[model samples]
Target: MDATPVAPPTRAADARLDRIPVVTRSHRIWVALLGIFFTFDLVDLNTFAYVAPALRSEWGLSITAVGAVTSVSFLGMFLGGLLGGRLADRFGRRPTILGSAVFYSTFSLLSAVSVNVEMLAVTRVLTGFGLQAMTGVLLVYVTEMFPREQRGRYQSLTLALGLLGVPIAAAVSRLLVPIGPGTWRWVFVIGAGGIVGVILSVRLLPESIRWQVAQGRAEEAEPVLAKLESEARGILGRDLPEPGPAVETAESGNIRELLRPPYLQRLTVASAVMICLILGFYGFSSWIPTLLVEDGYTQTESLNYSLVLAIGAVPGALLAWPLVDRFERKTLILGISLVVTVLLLAFGISSGAVLVMVIGFLINMLMQMLVAVLYTYLPEVFPTRLRGLGAGCANSVGRLSGAAGAFIVGGVYSGLGYTAVFLYLALVILLLGTLLALFGERTTRRRLEDVGSAPEPA
Candidate 1:
């Protein structure tokens, strides 16, 4: 009789053999560190908004000029997300992250030294290139680090913590704006500090084991997985299941994959949501202090009201953590969109400071929450093979839309009035909500694989 042929070792079995359970403690620590990094990133990105009035006064900037300064960053961000996503896939998440961090930090420091509006615009563009890379890479990292069950909650929490920078920037800007003759420059200087710290801390972080395995670098991934497993067991008081074998289905780093069929749809929905959200957010927020100033409040009072509005975002971020995983992603998005639309209209129509503040608080809460949800939901819709690319494309599209929105709002607010501009924003938000309800997929409590695969029949 002929000798029986042996079958090849299965990928799943091979993965099981190489599996290492990660420690919860280490995971939590890493998550906390990432959150800190995000805070600085937010501060760096948003400080320009808070300091806009000061910059305008000193530079004699027109509405269009101010809009150009703000929108230029988004232009860079648009390209960065597209390029960085592909780079992360090809080069690995760690290198792309490190590179972007260094780039942003260096440019942000240089921004403080800007001598003219032209130089400032250039620096802002460079800073945005780096800043945008962080978002896609960070989302990929978070998804791979946590297990499927807790992915939504953990992502939501991290996002919420990161958003703390919004209020922090607002508060710090208020403090610094009043102190020195050139206080706005100090805000940029302080923002640069956060990026530097992140760059240093990231050195101690490990590369993603999933990415390693996917690249068929099992030998290299072993030690990292072992460390993770040991740490997880220590925290959970039990050994966790080892990750499955490295299945290299397709190259993850290629940007072209995003243009393919199902992925194209996912990209479209995500980009649309981003455009709507940012338009609503920046349209109202960029002019918050100006609005207050127009309503007869002193500069001090305007800044104070803006501070109050910023503070309200903290609880909003916190509240979003649990709900993100519990409800359908699209539903949460739609609900927030509706709430914000109504609140924006209310805010525009009202004259009383107290009433405006109340509406502003509600609007801020919903906007912050929507951001967290969008970040968490968008990535979940793409497979690991193209997670970075999908995220990058969506983010890039959103940034482009945001840039347009900024320009449009600046022109409209300058030419028309605040009420008309806000009413227009309300209509945009309502339209976006409708689109989400009609086209957005439900992703709550589902595994990333489930969402990332081809869509099911209607």
Candidate 2:
């Protein structure tokens, strides 16, 4: 009898998929779709910031009460991030993303119809739950799908696109919030349209091939791998290059493994960076108009300033694309964080409107740069099985800290001053930069397969 034919190794699918070059038509299309998905998340993410001042004026809320409205959403985000990550790892990235889209979209419209502060806060908390979990899953999907060499660049593109929502939210609020009483409700009404994109994403987005291979579903992974190979061949117009040697990796789908060796350090570092960044980001960025209003700027002037500040965020994100592959992500994050610290300090001391706007613009720009870099950096540290869980857990820390920071800033601003709040933000940012520079591992131009599976020190 003839000898039994042997099956090709399963990891060949992974090897084949990884060898595809970046910047293909197919690749660009994928980025665009993911970018649209992220755009909605950001719109909902930032909706409250623009509307909070209006809400405060309408409800006759105290500063702490306004901050509480903001903080409640983050409280929901904390749970959402943790739960979303676990679900993505357990079920699939695509489904979690779809469900999150539906959940947030429905509740966002409900917020518009809310009759009182308490009702609006409840809707926002539910909205936050879906919004953040969707964001966590989006990062995981992007990290897995993009080419290793250009992962940072592509992720930055999505970030730039997502940051556009900030400006969009600002523009909407500037136009609508000043019209008359109850106009703030229109902000959420326009934002509810983001749900439409979800239907499109469910149809267009591909399931992650790396995820399939990691789950030991080689048979399922092969067909997806073949499609990717075909796309690469079309782009190259020739035979593909040989894939690198495959390293053996454990199929760990457990959250417990995240607390063990090879993952614990990543968890710690990502969580630290996330916590500080979110505190500084939301503590300042989301609260910009409110802070300005307290500092004596009119609502219209504050909204205009915020709109200009929001415009800077797009470039801030775009600037990272060219440098992301060239410089190590850790170094870039550190540098941007330091710039943010100085700008925050400068912003605290400045007096003139032009000066404040200029300083605020610069600060927001640098903040977005930090955002692009960290979003790219954090997801690179964990394995496919734990990528969602690890990122989710880290994101939870940031959300919770951000919630606390919002409250602290409100209390401090009400008692101490804007100067005190800026000082606190600057200090937090400085420590975050220092910690990342000292302890974070380099992930420049590294393949996801190698970066994800490589052994770490105990």
Candidate 3:
């Protein structure tokens, strides 16, 4: 079903990959390994937020200071997005993925040994960088390797696996952070568990076959392709389907192609969507526990509340699996954005514990659905040669806003109070919905080459 490009990349080759009915066993192993890697990505990403109360009591961190640390780490994510995308574009997705796992895991371990806020902030910056870098490339890898029709949901499936990290963070923060002094260190130690993922990835993951042919390294793609074909054959209990009809040979292009006509439009739309989404999503999620404490809830009560809300993440992603394949991705994102806006407004105004929990859970579910769909869509908008770079460009710019969001939300919460901050988040998602409605392009179930191609004349 997949292949090494024996000649230059051909329509025949792309057809072989596109028509594969199921993931081969060889490739499923990689998917499981990648799921482990991203699960840890979520763990390291949220560790700081979950442990904020402990940091406040033990190290005297104020909300303003938490904002500072959060902003700086997001800035690191901004850089990592750019750097990782470029690396993946040039060096290939496999190495970039493996290399970034090492980069982040090392820094996540370093987080456990931080002596003070400054030390923690420094470690967090590097950790954030590696996490984003790893993330951008992984999404690109999925875009290239997975079946075209099923790509969107597969993206969500991996994310659903990764979202397990949310509950992991919640449980550890609740159970371990309360055990007196220095216990929060145990949470960071667990965050460093990406090292285990990296080891598994080294053994189980294959170099991306599509990326190889895109770079004209057909020979290198052969062995991996053979193993995948064998597995796929066994699963089918017969010979593979004949390759589909070939279209024109799709010429590969680089990042400059995105700076030109069709992709530039898509890039702008994606960046706008991501910026607003980051503000709304991160504005709420990044500040939840800390804000609960600020509202006069005890740390223990806040963690209990957070743990309940974190459980929503898995269902949120799972809920999208069918829909992601069923609808146009852009339309789905716009619809979810509208729904999240309404829920956020309710979250802002509610006071009773039951009402608040219900609203929060819905918001978490819809937001994950939005995120899973959006990640699937991002890589689809660009050509394979520069897919990583293009997605990273938009993603990094959005992350820059994500950094700003910590400060913006913190300042708004400090000056105007909690309800006003949620109001602001409502406005942000509303803006996101408007942008998608206006400029978002459709990418559902299209070939990567065709999806990224310039429009045909009417």
**Top candidate when judged by lDDT against the true structure:** 3
TM-score per candidate, chains pooled: 0.90, 0.95, 0.94
Each model's lDDT comes to: 0.75, 0.83, 0.84
Which of the two candidates, 1 or 3, achieves a greater lDDT against the reference?
3
lDDT of 1 by residue, 23-130 (tens): 266567767767876877888888888777777778877767878988898898999998888888777887787778778878888888888889999999988889
**Model 3: per-residue Cα lDDT over 343-385, one tens digit each:** 9998998997788788998998889888999999888888777
Please report, as a residue range, the 10-residue window in candidate 2 with the lowest summed lDDT. 1-10
Rank ordering of all candidates by TM-score, starting from the highest:
2, 3, 1
The candidate, 2 or 3, that scores higher on TM-score is 2
C-alpha lDDT of residue 328 in model 1: 81
- Cand. 2 Cα-lDDT: 0.83
Candidate number of the best TM-score: 2
Q: Of the pair 2 and 3, which is ahead by lDDT?
A: 3
